[model samples]
Target: MPGLDLPAAATWGRLTTFLAVYETGSVRAAADQLHVTPPAVSAAIAALDAALGTPLFGKSGRGIIPTDAGETFAGYVRKMLGLLAEAAGAVRDADRGRVRIGAVATASEYVLPPLMASFIDEHPHVELSLSVLPRDELFARARDHAVDLVLAGRPPRLSGLVTNARRPNRLVLVGRPGLKTDPLTATWLLTGLGSGTRDTALSLLTRLQASPPLLTLGTSGAVVAAACQGLGVTLVHEAAVRAQLDSGELVSYTVPGTPMDRPWQLCTTSEPTSATRLFLAHVCDPGRVGAAAFHTRHRPQG
Candidate 1:
């Protein structure tokens, strides 16, 4: 046991590193998650431990385990980090700030609305704009700094772009209930070429070298409608098709390598502005937003 004296170890960087390590239980994993070197994470942890006069972690054979004290500290750390995000967002919105974001069709259309709503509710002074673009165009704009941030499914490896955070995403192969299972005989449905769902389907079909009768619908909604009418099977975001799937209008099929597991990445070019950072943090850390923000809207006033 060591003395629990609060000292100079309370710096923001160390707190962030500590939380990452506490959550991940691995220095290497925390470093990768924070986009920092392993040594940096180790140094921060060691400094924090020294300040508190106790080691936060202990070696458990081949793995590291959090100490009893470490677990106790984590409860407070979570609250402090949440407040940090809120305070930073509020202060950053002091100026008339603007941020431009580009995203793939699925992310922009289905994923970002609630997040944007929560951000707008919290930072009413901040102005936000969104652009829906193809994957290549999104990266092109991100590279040239035309867009401040991008949200999409797994970015391509490129120089100078930084991925700030990643969230889980799912792509499922959905069709009418008990529909034909033959890919060769079925008409493969597709949305616009800009759509990620279209890309996933095209990539799978390409790899399988099976080109069925193709139906090019313009939008995801329309494609889902066609699939409901038994036009063809389509790959789409699982969240997007949940209603139909639940009602027996649509059913997910277990195709090879699907439903595909993927990640929605938040990325940016060099040195994003404070506004962009605020939005990025808010979206990536959904728990950071207070529940009151969402409920505050459309509440009946006394």
Candidate 2:
């Protein structure tokens, strides 16, 4: 309520405009979505800045980008807007139950299916939707309230969100059978930019003093395929490439400092819906779903 003491109409307009700009990353795009002129959008943001007594956005390379303050404020605005939408929906149909979940490829392919099955069994009336996305995109979707909750790698620090660490994912360097272990000399296959696996791979390469990757694939599956064909070594969640590893199409190397233990997390808005809370409890409770089902599949044997 501290930030809500302003004139209601003006405050709502500016906040919504700010959120549109933040999500779209452009004044012109936000204007188009809001059905207003670009200049009008600029004016609204300027006025809002004046009211708040701090600059929220800064110019960056032919476009506007959020300042740290803007990013933080945008999170609050998103939560407020989401709560409003939920309130309206509840008024219309109080009994309606739904949840939208976004997940990274690792969790989506391995961890989510069984958990989702259990959730559906327990709460047959709840409507559920799951989106599989890369780590950065998953965080963006969660921040913008596009999904009620996101299950993925340990999320980066973002304002107005809560992260509940669930289980650990082990990352290993894998490649075609009989591949060399010298990372500096070996070609690297990696996921596209902004992927958590790609970040981890790069970090591992840096520690090993390796050169830049030779190829960047768009998905984990593609990386696995390329590795199987002797393209290059890749770092991936061990469970993701389990079948290939078992079939002898791929081999895992025990790189010093890996299998890196990256924790999986459940990220949600600071204020979660009742349905979202229920689903989180169901998934996070080890007695119900159990950590073994989530973490024990296809673990590498030394």
Candidate 3:
């Protein structure tokens, strides 16, 4: 049969060299393009011809012309190479087409809405999914590769994670606008288990040497809402309750060493997905994030 020999030892190099030679119509020209010697190109073509049991080219002056079989084979080889390139791109497109972004409740509630909206507007084709989890759960998911990017207060140091962006974060004690209850003896609203806010709140209490009446709430939102209704006083991330503070729904109390500095961080694994990188770049850009995302003119008391 005047077809391929189907030798088990046949290598991809032969077909590629044959195609390169076919394209340039000269061994030396093909060798230059491939960054190999003319002898190497000729040897590749010879090996390919031997495997196929047919000479794929014929002499034409100083150049070469494909035989009938070589001409036919070039078609299949061209399609094969084209399909290979397409396959590679298809795999990468999947990664680039979707973004998995996770954040702690405070960041998601306060900072992410506008930033996410802008990101969607800019990259309309990307499918974005956002999850709001407790700080510990968020970092755990990051370790497991279940999520692409994370935003929260300075997370505990972990291997294989990188903090890509940072901004000032302040935790403050807040209550209803005109509450006269002394914070030292007032009921302290605390968040539920697995939240960083609870630990921070407790630590602040220890520092102040006051153990007020404690109320356990399931979420920061719940705690803040409870405080607003004059139920009790609560500790919250300033960014999380920015809207409330500005609207006079909540008042920051004056306390020594209040407004503790806990920086908001955007974190990702050492190796991140293509979509993650795109979103990371967007969030890091000051122009994209805008002043309202984190910067505010209102003076909050805490």
Candidate 4:
């Protein structure tokens, strides 16, 4: 096994058995999970151990446990299996002309609906599924290939994904009319933790040495709604509250170094599906509805 090179098919089979045994703690239990005989499970593990030139498991009383090397190798096996499953899903979705998309709250609430409406109108045959989550969870789903694409603020450095900045995302501090006080002094209505809006608000507050928020809402819409009721000042995406700002229901404040700007990005796997590519083009095309909705700029008054 000095230069062991197992066949891909055998490797997958062996790894599958190894994972089952590692998880179940016994060959018989692994066989039960795989709908195979205990001897078959034992044979697969033996084959894997022989190929790797190392003992993967050690026998205990009526059970088995993975060795240190097996533990380290199991991580890679899980990733490989996950990738394989994603590949299968991608192929199925491509055949069915389906695209799954994940978006952060702001994009889901304000940006995607109009664009999706237009896209569906044009590409009526494409089946679409969209999930709106916090930025962190959205990125996680994108990285896992649970969604074909993700629309959100730019994610942190991720190795296996590609992020294209589709438009500018502007964050502004907003409050009701006649409430012109220091942002630090006013009660703050914030979105839940892990949202892009909340992250921006926390950063701005930190820079200003402001106190913690008085209240927290789960969604950006709720935070804006609370602010509109004259409850407290809140930092939110300008796109999310454009109608209120335009209607004078809420007024924007120009805090020092205000309007933190970031990019609204389209994130996808390195090898995106055809459906993903089609949707990305639709969003990026300047003449399309997505571009207009995403790129529209709003100037805030102090």
Candidate achieving the largest lDDT: 3
> What TM-score number comes out for model 2?
0.68
lDDT by residue (173-201, candidate 3, tens digit) is 89988777687788999998878888888
Which segments of model 1 are wrong by more than 4 Å?
Answer: 1-95, 288-302
Predicted candidate 4 versus true structure: per-residue lDDT over 1-302, tens digit per residue: 33454563247677889899888888898899999999888888777777777888998887788999889877777767756755755675443477788888788877788878887887887788889877777666667666778888766466777775357767888999898677678888988877777777777778887785479887888989999998899988889889999999999988787777766777888888877677777776678763453432333323
Candidate 1 lDDT tens digits, 1-302: 13434656778898889989998889999999999999999998888788787888989887788899898877677667644543454455433576778888777767778888888988787888888888777876666555778887877566778877766667888888877568545888898977767877889988777888899998888889999999998888886797898898998886677878766778886677778877776765537554312221122322
| lDDT (10s digit) by residue, model 2, range 1-302 | 22432354346677789888998999999999999999988988877776666778999999888998898887778777756655543343222567888888778878788888988898887778889878777777677766778888876477867775456667888888776557556788888877888888788778877675479888888988998989888888887888998999988876678778776778888877777777877876778788633331324434
- Candidate 3: stretches off by over 4 Å: 1-95, 292-302
Better of 2 and 3 by lDDT: 3
User: Could you tell me every candidate's TM-score relative to the true structure?
Assistant: 0.62, 0.68, 0.64, 0.69
Deviation (Å) of 99 in candidate 1: 1.5
Which stretches of model 2 miss by more than 4 angstroms? 1-79, 86-96, 134-137, 140-146, 285-302
Best of the candidates, TM-score: 4
The Cα error of candidate 4 at residue 267, in Å, is 0.9
lDDT of each: 0.76, 0.77, 0.78, 0.77
Better of 1 and 4 by TM-score: 4
